[model samples]
Target: MHSFFVWYRVNRDEGDADMVIRGMMARLACRSGVGGRLIRKRDEPGLWMEIYADVADPARFEPLLRQAVDEFDVEMFIDGTRRTECFLAGDAIPAICA
Candidate 1:
């Protein structure tokens, strides 16, 4: 399974960004069959992160996530680019850990 961690800086009002992000997450869950969580730095509310855990198919999920972002105009609320990182299960690469 692949897990996605996306982080970005919110350029607009935190409350408005939060509302829009929540709605976008809901749409993703319905359309992509993957649920997501939104969080932020404790001291820096403008910096937000979205966590999508245990994604069985990143090929399908990543595009859907991008589509939803465009559909919801999520860029309007953010500053700079959204940085996305993906990870694999530790056991998937056990050879490297030995």
Candidate 2:
């Protein structure tokens, strides 16, 4: 499986952020092989992170990303910079044994 991470900051005072994110998560929950979680940083109030795990297939994933951007009006909520990173399980290293 591959993992996708998205980090961004939003203006919490704006009412749209929470609704958009919750709607996106609900949609993701119904899709097969796709799962994710939304997290907010405790230290950095507006900073948020989304982590997703599923089979690696850009063709399938890209559309979802685009849809979210369009439907959620993400441009309005997202702060200065938004970053996304994808990682493959094989690229990771386990802790070394003593």
- Please give the clash total of every predicted structure, in order: 0, 0
Give all TM-scores, in the order shown. Answer: 0.89, 0.76
Scored by TM-score, the top model is 1
Name the runs in model 1 displaced over 4 angstroms: 91-98
Give the TM-score (vs. native) of candidate 1. 0.89
lDDT of 2 by residue, 1-98 (tens): 67888888996554578778767766754553576788889998689888887757856886777676676667678878678888777765889999
Candidate number achieving the greatest lDDT relative to the actual structure = 1
Model 1: per-residue lDDT, tens digit, 14-47? Answer: 8888888899999999998899999999999889
| Global local distance difference test of model 2 | 0.75
Query: What local distance difference test score does each model get?
Result: 0.92, 0.75
For model 1, give the 10-residue run with minimal summed lDDT.
89-98
